[model samples]
Structure formats: structure tokens, C-alpha cells
Target: MPTNQLTAGVCSLLNEPQHTEDLLNSTPIVQILSVKKVHSNPNAPNPVDRYRIIVSDGEHFLQSMLATQLNHFVDEGKIQKNTICRLDKFTCNMVQEKRLLIVLEISVLEQCEEKIGSPAGLQIPPGDAAVTPSTANQTPAAHHTAAATGGATASTSNTTTPAARGQGARSGRGPTTFPIEGLSPYQNNWTIRARVTNKSDIRTWSNQRGEGKLFNVTFMDETGEIRGTAFNLAVDALYDKLEEGKVYYVSKAKVNLAKKQFSNVANEYELGLEKNTEIEECRDSSSFPVVRYNFIDLAKLQEMAKDSICDVIAVVKETGDATEFTSKFGRTSTKRELTVVDRSGYSVRLTLWAKNAEKFTNTDSPVVALKGVKVGDFGGRNLSMSSSSTLEINPDIPECHALRGWFDASGNSENFQSHTNSFSGAGGAATFNRSELMSIEEVKAKDLGTSDKTDFFSTRATVMHLKADNIAYPACPTQGCNKKVFDQHDGWRCEKCDRSFEKPEYRYIISMAVSDHTGQAWFQGFNELGETLFQRPANDLVAIRERDEAKFNKLVEDVNGHQFNFTCRAKQDTYNETTRVRYGVQKILPLDYAEEARHLIELLSSPWAQ
Candidate 1:
């Protein structure tokens, strides 16, 4: 294992059919010459970026694709130019008349400052060549290799190359099945062997076009996953034919740009099934992977943007009874909320809708695995299951088993931090972990609002003064909107909404000065923080100001000298052609002296304190 020594002739051996089996079996050391990031489709709603690296074996260099599972190595800067790595597992395939090696598993050996040796591009073999299946039934590794390499049946004889298969597929001859990862809009006559990971119930929609019934299913193979949809007659023909967790040979479907708003699959293209699309069940599906998940911890959900889709796994801590509500269109639906806690010691609320809400009855702290759940910013951070989302309770997966064991052992006794509450409260006592806590002096020293991105931090401070003038404004009353409205003598008009209202709703936009032991800074807050401070609505304060000015001033004075914990967001703001840092209140909570005392005691008892 000498440093900078590479296994030469590895790329040349990859092109030779005789060395395919041996090369696939042995791990080869190689040097990475360069790395490039490619977006599958730049126009895709949520584009998938993959890394392509050129690896050299001291003599020949070859282009390779890094599997999505190993993308973190590139993202985290572990694998880069001149880096030496050992390829533990890989598969070679010919795509678009070029050779490609898909790196499935790899280990970093060393980082080099310069290239190890002079290497030329590996020559492509003559004629249309493809890997042929062995005489034996395909093993898990062989099967995955074939899937990444594209097109091979279990039989050794009558094997077809991927290029010839594409041509044959169009000519109605002996067609070859393609892998899901290599599928694109240009290839129409392609078949794929994939398992249905999730299927949706049939639903009817009415739009500008005629109404029709449709459903969609997510398909996964060894390489990647794609979403497929069937409408009208296709729905009637294929709705019942597809089942979750079942493998099938699918062909003759249309490949088009993916509708990302309706799907969270990483693939850039989606399949459209027609009535004549061919689909058949594959009984021997031992080689296909069951499912793939990229779960985010409950605590990490706070950092993610709102409305993003993600996967999560946790144990059900508490479940609420199903509640019925009527939509604005008069359609009734049911929704249930559950509090889920993970090993990260954080809990978040998850809402289930419709049939899922009505049928959920697991009361013994079952492990819940959710995929494609939408994140929300309401009450800090929460999750809601969309129509395309999937939920599994107490699945037989290893993560579920481990979570169940932990919950049974010690989770039930541990107190969990909740996303909905600013602090963990018990018996009228609150606690702060102080992980994000900062002092006013530290906030100023860090220049929190100088950057383009907003900075969020928490501080314990007391209100010094409140500016009582122009503290409230007339705003449009539309839900989810707080645009200021203009009064035109008779009625209030909202330019953004292009509508007029009889009157306008009054909302607080108050400015206040807060101070800690170090220093003081001015902060601006909206309706929520204002109500919390005044213990009343902004409209009441407005009415009181018009009738009795003395009472309004007295109320503002009462809020002064009150101590609280504040979460604030700071960002650079441009006003009147001048840019400056603007501080806004994100959340406010009453100060908990008991928790502060406990935190101080723990800090004093630590060895570092001595």
C-alpha cells in the first residue's frame, strides 16, 4: 500500500470482455484526474446534479459516473482532482456510443497535489459491445451491475448490445430492456425493469381541458427511480395492474420532462403510460432493492426551507383524534396530527390527511417512516403529508427496529424538545439548551446582518423603550398576505390584490429598543410579537389610541423593563438608496429564571470552568 502507486491497466482491462469478471471482482486503485458536475436537466423544476470524474490507472484514463449514493464524497470535498481512491465496486456500460464506468462503492486512499502519471483516454472496443449475462442466475452484485451497465437477460446465449437493442426495440424485433438511469426523452423504444415503490389512489380532476381520472406511481431500480402517470383509458388499463413493492417489465411508455411539483423523484424525466403500453410482472425479483430513503433528522428540519419535500423516520410519541373540516368548496375531509420524536431529542408535529388520517390507529408507539412530506414554517417547523407522500408504520426495516428498541428502553422517559414550543416546559418551568444563544455584544461583533443571507440568533434581553407613533397600519385582510392598503376616502384598496374592501385590518409594525448586559440594539416586530408584548390585539390598541391617548402611552410604558428571550433575524436592507443592517424579531418567549440558574450551575460544575 505504497502512496501514489496506482493499479495500471485497469481501464484497458475494462474494455476487454475476457477481463470483465475478474475486474468486477477485484478492487482497483486509481487516481482522479479531474471532476465535473453535470445537471441532468437544467430546466427541470428541481434539477439533479451528478458528479462525473475522470480516473486514471497510470496508463489509461476513463470517464466515470459517481452513483448518487456516493455523491457526498464530491459534495464534501473528499474526492477531487488528483485524489487517489480505491474502487471497491463498479460497473461498466456503453451510453450514447461512449464507455462509462459507474462507481458504486469507493474508498479514499490519499490526496495528491499533482497528477501521478501521464495517462491517455482508454480506447473504445470495436463493434457494438455489451456485457453478457453469465450462465448462472444473476446474483445481487451481477444484477446491479447489469442494471447500471444496461441490457442483459439472465441467459448467456442470445445476449444483445444496448445499441442494437434500442434499434431492435423500434423495429418490433427482439427488444432489450434499458435501465431507468439511462432513459431520456430521445429514447422512445425502451423497456425498463423496475419495482413500484409507491402507488397513489385514483382521483378525478377538472381543469380547462376535459376532466379525467388519473394516478401516478414511483418506480425504483438498482440505478435510480422515476415517476410514471396514467390518465383516462391508461388509468383503467394499468391502475389495478401495478402494485406497491412489486417488480415489472415496463415498455412502450412515453418519456417526457418530469413534472417536479407533483413528484420528488430525483430523475429528470417521467414516464407516461398509455393503454397500449406493455407491462408484465417479473416473478424473480430477488436482486432488486426493496426501497431507498434519505431520511433527515427531526432537529434538522428547522434548517430546511418551507414547502420542501423530505423523508423522516421517528417513533410516534402522541396521536390526536381525527378531526373533520369542510373546505371552502363544501367538501368535507379528515385530518389527524401526531407528535413524532427521534433519537436526536427533537419532536415535530406531522399531519395526515383524508384516508390516512381516518385509518391510523397504532397507539403503542410504533415507528413511523414518512417519505416526501412537506415542511412548514407554521409554529416554527412542522410536517404535512402531501398526496404523493407515503407513510409506513412499524416497517421491517433495520432503522425501524432500532428506533423501536430505543423507544422501549429509554425514549419514553426522556424529555424531548418540541418545534412548536420555544422552550421545553414542564410543571410551569421552562429550560433553554443555550446552543444558539448569543449576547448582544457577540451579535454585533459577528456582523450578523452584513451578508446577503439573513442570520438568525437568540438573545436574552429586556425591552428598554417602544416607539408608540405610527405603530399600526391598515393592511389587506386576505389570508396569508399582509400588504399595506391605501384608503381612497370611501374604501380601502389593496394594489397587490387588485381588490377593495369595506375597511382594512390593522396590523402592528412596532419598533422597540432591547438591551442585554453588554449593549443595546433596535428591533422591529410584526403583529404576533406585538400581541405577545401588549397582551392584546393591534386593533384594540388602535382603537384605544384614537379614543384615549393616555391609556395607549401607559400600555407602551408597561411593556418596558420586561425581560424575555428573543429569536431575531438580521439581514442587509436597502432603504432610500442606503443599505444598513435590519433586525427583525422571529420569536419571543418569557424569560425562565429557573432554567437560567440551572444552566449556570452546570457550566460552573464543568471541568473546563476550573
Candidate 2:
């Protein structure tokens, strides 16, 4: 093909003569001069279709090819600026705004040829060709024998011809690596330089087998984020060395299909660092961005469902009771509850368990930041705190001061109320009547004239008739459920279930009579508080009532006529919708209404009065 028919535009772009004889008759070959321009074509069906060229001596030939094709040339082909390419031929058709050219053939040549050659034969000088037989015979016999023995080695070295080297260099497996671009579609092994956004300290776990240590770190590259865990030996190798906010050249990581349900990121896959994984600290810190979060308002946390994780900033309004308990592992644990409030006109309870409880006990009035706190249900509303949750007390972070100022300026402190108004020494003394002190058996035995108008009230009642002594038994020690149990020796048996269990049951009250200056009421207590007030094991009380009624009556008399201040709470029962009240004696003191006893004391002290 001759090059004469090439257009002036092509000639000017190629900076070469345009002639039909040179294009059609002469070798139809050309060298890539330059990539003058590259851009996507909107008119193409595939939006990724692009137009580019190798300005071989610039018959500015425009070609319509897939975007992937251009990427292949840049990636696999290793084509770059100033690269030389030989264009065998191309299809050109005139278009309105831009010329359209389709590349038909191409050859990446090292350099431009000085002279054109015939299509039949191409030759080089004799010195450049392989040695002839005459040249080989000119050497000595001993030299020939040595050459024969080393012929295999010589052949091995010659086997990698210049052509082979060029092909190998272009195979996309060379030491001069390049970053992958336009990877929105391809899913394959990829190397990225990511920074250690978060790292975990070495944590040890002990089991029957042995004790081992493990740690994990979170990494973030420009492309995405991933989590890596190191165990045992790996922990010792990398735990102290891997620092947060430092970049690292990580490679040999295994890419696994990510479970979207378990991940919060946007990527479809995640990487795992294995034993063979390589990591090297990157000196340049400017390559990665700092970790940050736009925390959600704490007031909004009320609207979220229980167990929902949230980030919040709020002021600590008040600290709560610190309760200590034994965990399943037989370890002592303590937890303190606090109320955290924000500008949203809503507040939630935060229970800091274990270490957090002790640490925040003295932080009575400080602003706090909570991340990954699990919302929970407490007293019919959402509460939040978790073991993995992070709590910052009066941190230098701006959010802390902002929330503090807002709370102070808005008079938010005035709105803070005790979690339990009635139980926190707020409500005054309680009162109860004799009729309300009737035991369950007594109430059932009584044949009242009318249910609504029953005159059950009585004065000077003995504690013997007020307590459910016969029915009292050790109840389950579980936090919420406190049903009485039957003794089985091996373990206490639950009367409600007719089953034997391992854990020891607790003492709880089935009923109690409470009175004050105004009125009287019947009350019940669950296991823990019930046992505390009764001052006896529920099982022992039950046994005493069954074996010796006279003794039980004496014990009741000891508590009778004991004038004491009390507090009570009433809530409608779910079974009958009847109000069931519970009360505890707050303060017990000598009765002022005992006139006979006062006279006796005055008679004994007559000398002072005289």
C-alpha cells in the first residue's frame, strides 16, 4: 500500500510526506510518533469508547476503540508518553467535527528505520549474522572440544534473543510495576499502599489447650478499607511495630469475598493479611487522610431501636448506684449507671460496666463522647452502653466543649430528674391499714359480705397475721425471676416448675404489711431486696412456719407495733389489673404514742423530776 493518499491532516500530525506511492506501493509501515490526544467518544454505544493515536511520522489517524483497549495499551502494553509505535495500516473516513480512524495493524518498534526495504527480503551485514562453517573451522581442535562442551550454556544464553526480551518486557510481569487504573469493573488481585488507620494491642486468651495472643488492625487505602488480624507468633512480630496513622507498603494479602451484612464499608471485597503477607512502613504521611466522623446527635439516640450502635456527645447529668456482682466466670464485676443528655430534649441511661464503671465514678459532671455504644431498653426506653464501646471523659475534642456550653447556656441541668423519684428519698413516708396486711391464706379464707364494700380494716394488728410465713421459700437467684423453690439436697427444686436445679435459691417475701400515718397496704418483694428486709433465708422461714407455728408467731410479734417510716411504689398487675404495692421500712424508731411505757419511764426517773 502507498502512503500518498494520506490526508494533509495526517501528514501534518505525522510530520511526513504524504504520497500514494509511498503508502500503497512502498512498504505500508509507519512508526508511532506521539499520542497527540486521547478522549472518550460520547457518540459510541459503549460510553467507554475512546479515540487515540500513535503519531507515526502524524498522519493523525483517529481510531474508535473500546476504553478497555486503550487501557490495555497503557497497562499491559506499557504504552506511555514519548513511546514509539509502527502503524502497519489504518481505516480513515471523514466526519463532521472530527476525523474517525480505525487502527488496522501496529508494531511497537525500538527506533525509526533509516531506509525502506523490499517486502521480499530483509538482510543485515555479515558481521551481524550468525558465524558461518568457515569461521568455526578457523578455531583449534582443543577450542572446538571446549566449545562443544559449553555449547549448551552458550545456547541457553542465546536463546533469549532481543525479540524474546522485548516480548518478555511487554508481558506485564516486570519489576517496573505500575498502579492499576480504571478498575471499577475488574475483580482481581491488586496491590495497594494503605495506612494503618487503627491497631489493636496484643490480647491474650487462655483455654484448656493453651494460652495464645492475638491482635488486629484496620487499614485504609485510597481505594477502600480492610481489617487484618495477627495471631500468636504474628502478634509478637507486628503488634508493637504497627502504629496507627502510619502508611505501609503491604503486599501478598489474600482477597476474600466480603459479607455485606457484617461490614459497614462500600467495597464488595475485603483483604486478609496472612503469614506470608509483607508490610513495610511508608515514610510519607501525606498519602493518607485522618480518620474522622461526624457524630450523630445524642438526642436522636432515643429514636433509635435498642441494640443499635451509635456515636454521641453529651453531658453527664448524674451518676447512679455502683452495683457489684459475680460474673459467670466467677470474677467480680461492677457497673455504674449514668444519665447522658443532649440538646434534643431527650436523655438516655448509660451503664458503664466493669472498668469503665470504676473509671467514670468520679467524673460526676463532665462531658463525654461515646463511639459504638449499643442502645438498650431500660425502664421502657432506649439506653446505651457496650463492652466494645469507647468512652471519652472531658476529652480535649471540640465536641466535648460544644456540648458542655450548650447544656450550661440552655439551663438543661434544671430538667435533670432522678431516675427513680419515689425510691430516691423524694416521696414522703407511706401509710397502710390493717386490712391490707391480710396474708394470702387469710384473704382467701375470709367470707367478706361484699367484694366492693368489704370492711377488712382493723387496728392493732400483729405482724404474725401480716406476713406470708407459710409460703416463704428460697427463690431463684436470677436477676429478674425470683420464684420460690423446694429443697432437693443436690440442688433446690423450683415449686413453679417441679424441676431440680443446681444453683442455690434465695430468700424473698411473698407479701408484707406496710403502714404509715395515713393508710396501710399489702406489699411483695422479689428475691434480693425481699431477703434483705426479712433478715432470714426464705427456705428457713418456710420450714419454721411449717414445723413450729408458735415460734413463727413469736418472731412476728418481734416486728409488730414497730413504728417506722416507709416508702412504697404501686403498679397495676398484668393478671388482674389490680394495683399491687410494695414498701420497705426506711427508718424504725420508738413509738411516741405508747403512753403506758412513757409513764413507766417517768416513774423510774422520779428523782430528777422532784
Candidate 3:
């Protein structure tokens, strides 16, 4: 291609505004004159990289951005400075009074030695004077408001009326509403018209600061999404006012840096609602975009890190009855396990808690769309819903319909591979596969606990001896706070809560020496695992020890020689300037001889064994 020909169409879209739509749809070719990397937060764990590129046709160069999704082009040396490329797909947005072309898709045509023609910087008109090729139903004027205004009274030069300055006015026609993507701590005087994508129940917390209640809601617009949280009085005022899937005009809320540890929203900032925050329901919300999901397939869940949040769509293959359990803090909670499968031929367990568990009655293999569910490596790979998670049963979307059709046709007949290798026992109890069983000698030989990361493995061992000294600790009774409380004579005082409780909950911290054929080693277990081993609550055991020391000693003797399958976590721990590997029991399952024999037979019959 000639250099002059490449530069001939430079700034063509700006020069020929009348044919802008036609040119944008044609996938215009351009030359990359220069590329610069944008700086991002250094404190972020995994900050996304952004690139600003100056492109030219021949006579003029314009500023452009490479979308994050297309970062692979630059990373793989496919696209760089002085490279000619075809803009396969892109959108233009008016940001900060300038036109920014965001390239979504591109193909490198040829790599050149130098910049294409002597191209000068292209100038873009402000506000509505410049026409952009964005498909979103947003105008330059509204985008200008989003970028320029910080909540002072609207300028007289704009079309906003004086009555629009206050609350109770409709959006679009009243005050100019800003985009959620444009929200930042620097901009305070802004109103946003967004739909509630997800809402969390009001939850109370107590720390050294004091006790207070808060609720969170995720809001979305055509531009982007942001999370909003209201504390105490604001929670009481706004909790009942906001409904999931409803649109509202919100303003006067403070914006702060996002806490990435808690949220999966992509925005860099979040909203803090106050007592005087204005929130009026918007009746005209048809123009707003619906809740978006970046769904990951079940087969790929294993590649993701544990505790990461993700969205997934799968078929409910099996549902378990809800079971209630009391926490160490004496708070009762309900949870149910579900076996869900997807087209990837992988099955994973999904746990639902509280109201979500109780309300889930779908038993007809309904397709479920889950958003913001947490990934866990529990039985290999599993999912659990959090308070901010969104669950849609049989959603009237194309993805749901397609999954349903696939399941009814051939998906149901396909035998899926489960993440955990388990089978049913005689009484319908779950039996673990013996293939994962590791001998105590093999564990030590592999130096499993030598690294900083914790290692998990299963083993079958007998309880050689049980330590009966200091077996339990008095923990704070507050829900979710199992910290050990100190005795302050009058009552037990919890430093974490800065409060005193009449009676502290006794939680078990069992230490036992276990032996396999290889060797004997000591292991520790907390509350849940200790309860499973003793078959009684730690509090009851404490009472028995105080009332009848003979019976408590007898109980310990009875469980001394019992053998069972134990899943344990091993990590290097340092105590008093000494470091050693410590094994902590995670799960205790009763031994099933019948299941063990079947596993042996299956293993012997395998081709590898032969």
C-alpha cells in the first residue's frame, strides 16, 4: 500500500460528518503512528493495562484507545507503533470534551518501518458539535454532564431547568443524569439514572468502632455498573426504597475508592449513601441496559483461583434438602447443596444459604443463571452464593433457552464428570474414592507442608491418643466472631466487639495423635471437625467434665482407637522461634468397609492395573 494512500482517509470521519455512520460500518483501515501505555493503580493486585494509541490515515492523527479485550494484539507483538491495521469493530465516545475511539476488534494489515504520512493531531468539537458512532442511547450533552459536572447548580447554558435541581423530578427530561462509569470522588454534584442489578439484605456488624447496620446494592446503566452501600440511618431509609431490577434517580451520595476484596464490580469507585441522598423511582427505564453477566463454563472453574467471584449458567441435576446447623457463636443457619451441570460435561456442587436455599424449589432440571457466585476448591471445584449474588431461575434470555434446549435433547443423556470422586454407600451415605488417599509416610516424603501455601490431602488413620488438656476455649457469642473471649470476673469480655457477654460459647480445639502403618503424628482440629469426632458439642463436653470427670475420661478412651478417613490441611507454622509443619484436620468421615472393598475391586480391574 502507498504511504499517501494510507494517509488519504485520515480524519475522514471528522471531515465527512454526514457519512460518518457509513464509514464506521465499513471497517476503515488506518496506520498506528504512536502507542503509549497508561498508568494505573500500583497497589492493585492485578491491575488491568491500558494503551493509548495515535492513529493516522494520511494527513491527520487522532487519539484512540485499545480496549482491554484486545490487549493480546499488543502483548503478542502483533500490533505496535507504525503498524497498519483494519478497524474491524470500534465505538467512539466523547470523553472529557474530546472524541476517544475505543477499538474493540482489529487485524494487523502490515508492519511499517516509520510513521505513515506527516500527520498532524486531529481536533474534535465539544458537546453535540461532534457526532460519535456509539450505539448506546447517550448523547454528547449527557456525556458532557457526566464528565464535567460536580454537583453544583446546572449551568444556564445547558437545557436543565431550575426545578430539576431538586428531587422528585423525572430523569432525561429533568436534571441531566450522569453515567455510572463517570462516577468518582472528584465529582460530587451528579445524579445517576441506573437500575438496581442486585441488592443485599441489611446486615449488622459490631467491631471496635461500634455497632451499625448496612446494606449494599449494585446499580447499572448503559455505560457501566457501580456498587452503592448505605450505613445505619441511610440503610433504614433506603433499604425498603430500592428494589432489584428497578430504575431510580440517585444523587447526593458520596463516592469513594472501591474495596476490591469485597466487590466484583469493574468500576474503580463505589457509592456511599447518606441520610439526605435523593432517590426517586424512574418510570421511564426502557432505554437502560439490563443486568450483564460474564458467564464462565463449569469445566473452566478449576483454572480459577479459590474465593474468586464469577458468573455461571448451568442445569440443576440434583438438589439436596436444606440442613440447619448452629455456628460456634450459637447462631443457627440453613444451607442446601445442589449438583449443577453444564454443556462442558462437568458437574459441580453449588451451595445456597438462608433465604436462597429455602426459596429454591426448582426440581425439574431448571437452568439457573448465577451472577457473582464465589468459587471454592472444596471437593475440587464448587460454587457458593453470597448475599450480593443474583440468582435467576429459568430466565427468559437466549442463553437460558439455548441451555434448556441442549439439556432436553442430549445433555441429559450425557454422563458428566464430577469434580469430586465419590459414590453412594449402602445407606445412601457419600463414600470417598480411595484413589485420593495418601499414606502418612508419603505425605512427609513429599514435603507437602514445607511451602508457604497450605496443602490438603486425605488419609486413613487411627486415633492413638487424645489430648484432654485445655480441649476447649470460651469464644465470643457474637455471630461470625469466634474470637476467644477473656474472663473479666463479672462476665466474659470480647476485645473485638468491645462488649461483655453473660456467657461465652465454648468451642472445641481438639488435639490428637494419630497413627497409620507408616508412622504417628499429632493433628489439630477446630469446632466442626472436633464436633464430628466427639459426636457432641464442645459446651456439653465442658459440662460433663465439670460435673462427672469419670464419664468425660471414659468418652475420650472410647474414641482413642477409632479409625476413619480424615482430610487435613498442612502448613508451616512458627511458634516461639521454632518452625515446623502443622497438620489440621478439616473433615472426619466414618470408615465404610463395604465401600472400601468395592473401590479395591474397581482399581484392580482397571487396564492400568492389569
Question: Which candidate ranks first by TM-score, i.e. highest?
Answer: 1
Which regions of candidate 2 are displaced past 4 Å?
Answer: 1-201, 206-211, 220-226, 244-250, 255-271, 286-288, 320-326, 329-336, 353-364, 380-388, 393-398, 416-610
lDDT values, one for every candidate: 0.76, 0.45, 0.73
Q: What lDDT does model 3 reach?
A: 0.73
Model 3 misplaced stretches (Cα beyond 4 Å): 1-51, 55-62, 66-116, 122-179, 188-193, 205-211, 278-287, 325-333, 420-610
Task: Identify the candidate with maximal lDDT.
Answer: 1
TM-scores for every candidate against the unseen true structure: 0.61, 0.38, 0.57
TM-score head-to-head 1 vs 3, winner: 1
Model 1 C-alpha lDDT per residue in residues 554-580, reported as the tens digit of each score: 999999999988778788999999988
Q: Candidate 2 at 438: error in angstroms?
A: 33
Q: What's the distance in Å from true for residue 367, model 3?
A: 0.9
256-365 in candidate 3: lDDT tens per residue? 77787777666667899988999999887786667777788999986776677788999999998996644554556788889899999999889998889988986689
What's the CA error at residue 525 for candidate 3, in Å?
6.6
User: Arrange candidates by lDDT, highest first: which order?
Assistant: 1, 3, 2
Minimum summed lDDT over a 10-residue window in model 1 is located at 165-174
Displacement of the residue 149 alpha carbon in candidate 2, Å: 60
Better of 2 and 3 by lDDT: 3
Clashes of each: 0, 31, 4
